[model samples]
Target: MKKVRKILCCVFATVLMLSACVDEEIPNRNTPLGNFEALWQLMDQHYCFFDYKQKELGIDWNEIHDRYYKRITPYMNNEQLFEVLCAMLGELKDGHVNLGASFNYGRNWSFWEDYPENYHDSIARSYLGHDYYIASSLKYKILDDNVGYVRVESFSDAIGDGNISDMLTKLAICRGLIIDVRNNGGGQLTYAHKLASHFTNEKQHVGYVYHKTGKGHNDFSPMKSEYIEPAKGVRWQKKVVILTNRKCYSATNDFVKCMHTFPNVTLMGDKTGGGSGMPFTQEIPNGWSVRFSAVVFLDKDYQQIEFGIEPDITVMMNKADVLKGKDTLIEKARDFFKD
Candidate 1:
């Protein structure tokens, strides 16, 4: 029920499809001012976070336009103008936003960079050892303590109910479950939704999604409530802990949001990397493509999660534990189950 596809990917695909049709003449994307105007207008009309950013980040679209517009001149080189345009887009502090060129790509990745990295690959690998079960992108095993450990790196790969049910049956006897999704930059929303469905046997309210309706920053369609129907396959019955970090963004963030609503599900670790905006793609006059968030996804109550979500239990990885090749979060979760 919660959104499965990231907004940007959906919109970008649609825009690419429409652009493929020969109904409209291709816009002149050769001049600096033309590209600048096109990018500026694209964000001005379709970018969904302006209103929220204005209140939260103190961004004024008009002022940003005025500043970036001055940098764009007919005589300016593409490299120089691209730098200015990228800078203009960077103020949003969004990871889903990017400007692509043949030689370079411009993006705002401060979402994860500005936060503490709570995951260590070596440490996690040590826990998985040499014989971990692989179910698509899901790496799982029953820990020595009889705790179910499942590490999901990304949701890009497709998985079915049969696979999920088989995994659940394998770990069925565990006292508890730990789902580690740290550093997962996200993939498909469907995977997130499907994985979350197993934790509940009833329909669960997840969040809301709204699309831009008009050019106005606040012009949006009515918010729609999203639900996650319970899985038809085997579901977990015991306490479950979802591990998170700043790198758990996009679909992973949505998965965390849905899991937070399940009874006995505890979200542990650092804040999530949020990318709740649906993105749309447009091109500049120079053939450079600009992608931005065009759809807004809200929490069940209509609150914004564009930045990220806080975990229920804020646990940072212990450095002393890492030296021992242990994930502090997983160990802590094991203790929780034993208790």
Candidate 2:
């Protein structure tokens, strides 16, 4: 019986070796249908919001494929093909999703389209005036009412420990602080997270992040808790008013999320442009780079923030106020800060 088992094992090993030596034909990646399949499979497997989107946005992935497949043809040009793919991706309505090529790129900006432009660079500059202090990338000045007004146009710029220390130290005597982030399109989340950390005294749970683990859309790893540890630098001790608007997105949106966890922080202005997904990029067979939200994040209570977060006070810039070169949101924040 042992001799027979040894003979059978040898026969199996021989067959496996012969199978391994055979060459397999790779799929054609240059064809239109081929590129389509690559992009489709990439999103189908890795997009983080499939399950959530189907439930909330009623996105039928299979149906989208069937509808868009007709647009692909063997004779279509690259531009024509790219347009079709962009149109297909537009259905997601997620700003984190994008397709980039050497010629042009695709994105969805309806998050702020048709919404009020609640922030103006000219107005912010007026508030800062000639003597406004500059600490690294931060622009700050004291309001007439003894409130500190800090306008952070974008998180794209980096801020350091010394920068925060200097800004906070100068504004320490103010009754309250206004962190205005309107029209801030967002960039590095590290800056936003680090900035938000200064408002809290202890470790804070801001949200949870989940990533894909399999090809199935529903397959996801367990949600990982996200925390913002208190900063080692100067922490603001006074009340805080975070001014936001429809233009605040990406890391800025996340900044608002983190601030929501703090008791001293109050959001005043328009709803944020929601873009909670953590983006991941890939290149298709045609060399075009495609990006999608590969991770899902929920608020501290496990709520979806993909649409956006609302401010405690929904303040808008009144036409009269704007004509007079005054920002209503800033004025409202100043009133809230009055002691």
C-alpha displacement of 204 in model 1, angstroms? Answer: 0.8
Against the reference, the lDDT scores of all candidates come to 0.88, 0.89
Mark the regions of model 2 whose C-alpha exceeds 4 Å error after superposition.
Answer: 1-28
TM-score per model over all chains: 0.90, 0.91
Top TM-score model = 2
Q: Please give the range of 10 consecutive residues that has the lowest summed lDDT in model 2.
A: 19-28
Residue-wise lDDT of candidate 2 within 203-278, one digit each (tens)?
Answer: 9999998888888988989999999999999998779999999888888999999998899999999999988888
Output the lDDT of residue 330, model 1: 79
lDDT at residue 230 of model 1 (Cα atoms): 93
Q: lDDT tens string, model 1, 180-205?
A: 99999998889889999999989999
Candidate 1: count the clashes. Answer: 9
Each prediction's number of clashing residue pairs:
9, 0
